[model samples]
Target: MLNRRQLLQNGLLCGGAAALSQFPTGMAFADEATRLYWFGSPARAERTLAVVKLFETANPGIKINSEVGGNDYWSKLTTMIAGGNAPDIYQLAPSRFADYARRNATLPLDEFLGKIIRTDKLMPNALKLGSVDGKIAGIPLAINAFALLYDTAIFEQTGLKPPVETTTWDDFAKLCVELTKAIGKPNLWAVGNCARYSYALEAFLVQRGKRLYLDNGQIGFDIEDAKAWYGYWDSLSKAGGCVSAEIQALDKNQIDSNPMSKRNAAMTIAFSNQLVGYQQLAKNKIALTSLPILEGSGQSGLFYKASLHMAVANNVKNPELAAKFLDFFINDLEAGKALGVERGVPLNLAVRDVVAPTVDEVSKRSIDYISSIADRVGDFPPQVPIGASELEERVYRPIADKLGFGLLSVAEAAQELISQANRILKL
Candidate 1:
């Protein structure tokens, strides 16, 4: 493992003439490595490096210079782009994809698909999520949908029927209250308070025939929509159906910190693909199910999205080489085996099948769950508008936290969210 100084000394973290200067004159100048960067936990980074090694071994003479970023990834990436030194291949977040595309930071990949990159097995919705304004700006690495994941052991103990596809939010709340009462366990709640979760909020809004973003790049839903969404969890929390704010605050929403994984809650709202990781963290069996539908509204509002994407820089020095590496990273069976479902279910069906048999029972269940709901999911929503990430992580999350902590009324939280989101979106 290379430390920061070692990475800088090796030129992996440098660029251009400065980077060349870091290496021994002959060795570094000889190989024109296709630089790659991604931001993730250490585990995901290890899996990615394994795939990189596989790619290098399979295609001799083509070296890869890969770097993984930590907490400051987005800010650092912005700096790199501003300085005209972005990596040849990098991970693109769905929230920022359209923003990058509009800024010409990403190269259009329409020319590479089906030629350099295999597309026949890729899910159409995955490709759709990576595209902006009819141009394919990025290639999706995986596909995932929002879901309510619960502990089967807990449900059985309570003798409560677990939530299913057709379960309404009302029904879900009732079950939560009942589950908490029946369990009568200290510190354990029926469900985590997901009012602070942006994904859950999006799913709820979509069920009401509204979404986080409209086609025109404005905040889509209004105060009433947000009010109803928050009110659902708030009312449930008051009735002992959901964990209190203090308990919920212990979870930062990552797999390791999630309430369900911590045994502080029985159920949680998370992506379908996360079941593999969540199950590994839990002592008992965890299962995935559709998020409860809005009562009296026939809309499922479930959507399949690219969990993340791989994009080439618009100014890449070796476009063909970058495409070849991305093709191997995304479509190769060996890469699939190395990555498993860490990134989400593979977007490439053939690779998914190749990887499926190699994964554990929990991962296999994740693959099966995604397949079961794939046909019913709505189309990928509009490209997340610029500033939507800020709206979600910065504005929406804090406001939701405040609501959960009982620092703000439902109407107050709703108003704050809309006003802040609109201001960020410049609407």
Candidate 2:
């Protein structure tokens, strides 16, 4: 029997051979099709398989094998790379990109740009996130931005108009308070407080014209920015715009789930990809609006962040073939239409336009809305520094908990967070 590594490599080798026999071009067949290992949830696995099938059909000579695991993806990937068995294509997170790039775990695609791929057509900010140290380490699979999702029926019932394009954060806060009081239930919240969600906090900061990270990967803003952000939400909670601490602590998922779905909250900040789930949960129409700008900010202040789902490893034997397959997967119109935004909003410009006409009503609306505001969206911050992801979870989450629980004033929490984040980044 073959050893584990030999068996795995052999399977890939044979699969590549079988794949090559189906294509006519000898040059294409000369290279072996590459294997991809992904660490994603089971739901994503199912959607990804459909996309892969489409890719295989388009390029019959390319064989792509995917391994799906919900947990231990990073650890498993780390072990595989250590053993020289890393997959050609894999998943990468923004926070982990620098770590991989520093250790030479990923290939830089700068030389291959325009030769094998034209990134010019993609949303400029999305295309930029793939570059690390002036080289492209990976391609963005999707673009996700925060949007305010509201229950249309709740607004109608409360005699409150939906948030308009020109609505300010102050207007939104007043609306939240009015909506909560009209509902007259301690169980109901006007706005779902996801202060623990870093993206939501980041959106608030951005709306205030603050960058989340500096050029050198340092904490970009002073502690006062953080305080202003937390203070807004903390005040909103005090004004009954958010759920009480006891309820928030009992069920964390409620912020994005049934509470909003069942009309317990009038509005919540969520990603473009989550609209589908919200629609299903909402008995009435669910509408999405851009995040409100801060009063007098003058800047729209929203930023586009890459969903950075998949990446290819450098140690794989068939780098060129893997890159080709990725190109097809992201750029193919038919494949994208079939995949929809299951992975997130498609990053490929052509593919997005092609898929837009065929998607569901809600998805179409989302695409249109994002397209209208594309020019206003800024690029994501640089790949987060090592331990940055942990800082968000350990330090930031606890600080948010303290503020939500009324244990720490916004000023105190902001100071602690900045000090802790600076210390972690310094390390």
Q: In candidate 2, which residue ranges exceed 4 Å CA deviation?
A: 1-33, 39-43, 250-264
Residue 158's lDDT within candidate 1 is 78
Per-residue lDDT tens digits of candidate 2, residues 47-106?
Answer: 566667777776776666655544567887787788777767888877687768767898
Q: How does model 1 score by TM-score?
A: 0.91
Top candidate when judged by TM-score against the true structure: 1
TM-scores for the candidates: 0.91, 0.86
